[model samples]
Target: MSGWQRVLRGMLDILYPPPPLCALCERPLRHFLQGRGAVEEPSLLCVACEKQFAFIAGEICHVCGRPWIGESCGDCLRRKERDFLFSRSAVRYNDKMKELLARYKYRGDRKLAEVMAFFLQQAWRLHYAEMKVDCLTYIPLHEARLFERTFNQAEEMACLLGKRVGVPVYGMLERRKATEKQSKKDRAGRLHALENVFSYAPCGKYDLPERPVIVLVDDVYTTGTTVAEAGRAIRTGISGAQIYGLTVAR
Candidate 1:
């Protein structure tokens, strides 16, 4: 943030202070209430709530980003083809993460988008900081689903991440048709159902980068079927593009 932005933020804080209670646990933040230390950005989570995150670290699969002893996980090893170059996730899809995502995606708790985007930013820094990311795009929701949900969680996180990372966010693909929820299906079922569901449909206003390195953003990475199909659609539009998947959880 710039100096003037900081000044403006401070002014805003004085007029409208952040909530004293943690967003999840609703415990009062002693530090904020006491006003003892220099405040950073208004925190949505308490230290305890933050500790619940199971961040992905240490050795991981080169292809899938799953915690593994070997370079590649068995699933990736057995896969005949993958559209995207590779994929990385910020955290494990544990019980806490599941609940958090449910609140955001299902309950329409938009405030949690910041928390999800923060993890995506961290994942980018940890894994793709050195890479040349031309732009960021997201797995698009179908029109019907988008209307029903009011907003796309993946798109929200991608936009927030784009602002923080100085990368442009684009709508490079769209769902051709809506299918049944992937959660109900097994890996093979998901793969078969998602086939040819995504289609490249870049926005007319923005110019496409030549042979770009595109990062596909999403809330979760399960069987890798979703992003793989989306990447394939992107390839159909931009043949030379190198695609990578980044999700909040795997």
Candidate 2:
């Protein structure tokens, strides 16, 4: 940010502050950190709330990468025979997590996206670090939705992660069809609705690197239809590309 822009934002922050302190913590961080120490890093959660929600654990499906109660979610154990069946998300879409995602995505809180990306990076390091990924791409927003929202939250998260992980972020997947919200639909309904909705194209004019892999990013993964369709496009439209997905919500 430029100097003037920073000054303006700072002024606005004081005038109309973003929710003071962490959303979960009712206590103000100014009070928490008072005389405790000088800070060298950026953090709002006085270490305890930060550490409590630090990581998402327990058994997760190898294919869909969702936290499961039993051995595996039905989608993971049975992916209906596809080239790219594996998928993963950083956190589950519980009530609290959903509120955070809404704040970042709809309320234009980019900093919240950055904090959420921290969890995403942790999930990647724990589960997907061994995968030789070539690039990161976000599940693209439709042109209409892109205009309506004025930003793509998934792409925002991807750019943050790409900066830290030392990988290129590409907007390769295109949304050819617009559909209703998946959150309100059943799994079969979602899978059928998006069958002809997405397509994959070349990342750019340059020839993609050899044995290049692609990681798809999205805000949420409920029914797995969106990413599955996008992955199929990558497998068919492009060659020699391994596809994966990273989502904030599962």
Candidate 3:
């Protein structure tokens, strides 16, 4: 941008200062709660607002990232096979998270990518930090949807995560089938819809690592079908691949 544009932006920032507000709840974050450590870095949400998010921690199902309430979640136990080693998410898909995602994704607010990626980084630290994650890649968007949305939310978050975590993000996957939206579908419908949806994209000169430990990134993990399908497709293209799933919410 030109210097004049930069100056104008600075003026605007001074006139209408960016609010130090929580992303989920528009409450001002400037007020530090009493007895809390004020020296700590400020997060995207205020203490009270942040408390509202149900962060996924403790014993979780390896397949679905849900709290292990039973011997094994029915979804993971019933499935005879899965391509990905495991899947995990940062937070629960609650109304607050949904609203944040809608603003970032549907409403074209790209700045929220950083906040979303912050949680993703935490998820990685909790789940995949010790694992040998060779490279990171994100779920692809079909051409039509890509054109309509103008930006891939998953890709944007993944790039930010890659930078934060020192992982090399690669564009090695593509959505070959523009399947129907899975949000409204039931488990069976979602499973059927995701079949053969992902395909491997050729990477020029970036030779595949031997028995690569790949982590597939996505915005949300409703059911494991999408990531499983993606893992299957990637394994088909690359030999001896171990796939894993990471998402912002479960």
User: Largest lDDT belongs to which candidate?
Assistant: 1
Query: Which pairs in model 2 have colliding backbones?
Result: none
Candidate 1, position 68, lDDT: 90
**What lDDT does the true structure give each of the candidates?**
0.87, 0.73, 0.84
Cα-based TM-score, every candidate: 0.85, 0.77, 0.84
- Runs of candidate 3 exceeding 4 Å displacement: 1-42
User: Candidate 1 lDDT, tens digit per residue, 79-126?
Assistant: 889899999998899999999999999899998888898778767877
Tell me the deviation in Å of residue 133 in model 1: 0.4
User: Candidate 3 lDDT, tens digit per residue, 39-89?
Assistant: 234577788877777888887885788888655688899988889888889
The segments of candidate 2 whose C-alpha lies over 4 angstroms from its true place after superposition are: 1-44, 51-54, 69-71
Candidate 2 lDDT over 1-250, as tens digits, reads 9999999999999998865666445566653322111323345555566644424566777777766677667766676655564777766677768778788877877778777776677667766677778888888878888887899888888999898778788777788877878778787888888886878766685446765688888888777777878887777767767887788778
Q: Which stretch of 10 consecutive residues in model 3 shows the poorest summed lDDT? A: 32-41
Shift of residue 72 alpha carbon in model 3, Å: 2.8
Q: Which stretches of candidate 1 lie over 4 Å from their true place?
A: 1-23, 26-44
Report the alpha-carbon TM-score of model 2 versus the true structure.
Answer: 0.77
